[model samples]
Target: MDVTTPPASGDGPGTAPADFTAAASPGTVTLAWTAPATGRETAEYELYVNGRPTTVIQFGAGAVPSGRVEHRLTVAEPTGTAWAVKLRARLPDGNWGSFSAERRITLVA
Candidate 1:
């Protein structure tokens, strides 16, 4: 998917990403979610790990409101440690939305 940076303002507040899910393997986790319906384009998505912000991205081109976005992340921490993750996005139609529900993940060695 494509990605870009835009100001965090819109006509109305955007909705949160839905159906967040994760899968884990040795040292890594794959995260996925359905983006919110933000109209024309999907704005910036902020990824939080362990309760702290980690990354920001956009689901370029197609993955806007209803698209499913998937991300693979490498966690250097030891396996079995809980990884709490969530996402907040700047909706193209409104201000940044609240983060999606938290998803806890654990890597497997």
Candidate 2:
């Protein structure tokens, strides 16, 4: 899959997260990112895999910006595969933030 660079700052819904990371093991890949200090309570996170929107992860009402968020994907491929993953924060107003830096991971069999 193609790797997409994050958009310029102040271009999208909000600021993107920093220090994005990903780890892969067997059939699963885990993605994590530092929360942004947008001053809005994040309601959810949109996860993109291979440039496609794959899932939405919801946050608690009292979620803190200093905390990190993580999501694990159970890939369906038997021989493993390479994936480009990114994340965007969703505010309580239902607006999405700029995508975090993309992280690439290769799941091994």
Best lDDT among the predictions, by candidate number: 1
Identify the runs in model 2 with alpha carbons over 4 angstroms from their true place: 1-14, 60-66
Error of 2 at 101 (Å): 0.7
lDDT minimum window of 10 residues, candidate 1: 57-66
What's the CA error at residue 17 for candidate 1, in Å?
A: 0.2
Alpha carbon lDDT of each predicted model? 0.78, 0.77
Q: What digit string (tens of lDDT, one per residue) describes model 1 on residues 1-109?
A: 9999897676664488888888889877898888777665565789898999889866566554457877888778776888888988786655778789998887788
Name the best candidate (by TM-score): 2
Clashing pairs in model 1, backbone N/Cα/C closer than 3 A: 2-60, 10-94, 11-93, 12-94
TM-score each candidate.
0.73, 0.74
Model 1 has how many clashing residue pairs?
A: 4
